[model samples]
Target: MRVLSIIVLLLTTGLTSCWPTSVSFNDTGSLHACLKHFQMDPLENSAPNAPINYPIELTEAIKSGIQNNTRLLLSGENTKPQVTITGKITNYVVSPIALQEGDNAAQNRLTVSATMDIYFDCPNDNYTHEMKVVSTRFADYNSSQDISSIESQLLSEINTQIVQDVINQILSNW
Candidate 1:
């Protein structure tokens, strides 16, 4: 009985001492911070297509995109901006290349393309400004990978980059 009790104590000690050795994310957390900084509350997930408008509509979009992401939901929260920027992801590009992978796998080169509309609404200024910024990035993923999963991941990663870039732009121009 004493040996059994000792074994139980040791087992419990080991179990309680265990923890996740690591936490990982590609860009979700940073993206979330950007969203929260912009003061977006995410709506339930559905088709990416949501109603859009000239300026304020873009605002909702920036909010929606950030809100939908798990990382952004945690980090990207701030009071709604007096002047905000928003845009839609109109075009996405996926092309093949002969780039070498770490394991020398024949895979396609990943690239992301999107058009962004930036909003500048300042009550102090007499003019409300809207501008478009186009952004792109190359995502390195195994070429010999599943199309759907790679595409989804590439888009998410680039979207996070885009959101970060756009937020930086807004901050600078302000």
Candidate 2:
């Protein structure tokens, strides 16, 4: 009985004294802080049917969206790991969707397609991801309604969708 008690005590001591040295902490936690130091390059407009020569709509939207997204903190200029986002608007289309009584267009759809590459200057092995994002908007128009205003509104809607897509892509990479 004394030998049996000594064996039990020895077994418990041996089990408790061994600390696993194989476990290691993840270093990816710093990546989130690094994401705050972001920089956006001007988006290139390469669409053949693009009405404007510059991509102000697309560029401004993405910058604003990233700055406003809660998951990220925008750092104007910092020494941390830098995040660079570059992209181009590959497609832009405005087409009539609905016809009026006289065969005139009553409603139209606007679509914008873009591709973006996100690069992180961090130590992580996976630091870059290419994302293709698209947005579409529909508007009802007639002779009385202002065409420019409608177009602007449609563009705004498309920008909103694009921003959401960009945010989703970045979050999913994590």
Q: What is the TM-score of candidate 2?
A: 0.64
Model 1, range 1-174, lDDT digits (tens) per residue? Answer: 999999999999898789677777665432222233333333222223322321243345456654554233322344445334434445344566665756455656555445666554445545465656666665766666876676656656665676666555544444
* Candidate 1 lDDT score at position 153: 65
With candidate 1 superimposed using the best TM-score fit, by how many Å does residue 167's alpha carbon deviate from the native?
0.9
Candidate 2 lDDT, tens digit per residue, 10-70?
9999997896757756334324544556777888888887768437877888878977763
TM-score of 1: 0.46
Candidate 2 residue-wise lDDT at 65: 92
Best by TM-score: 2
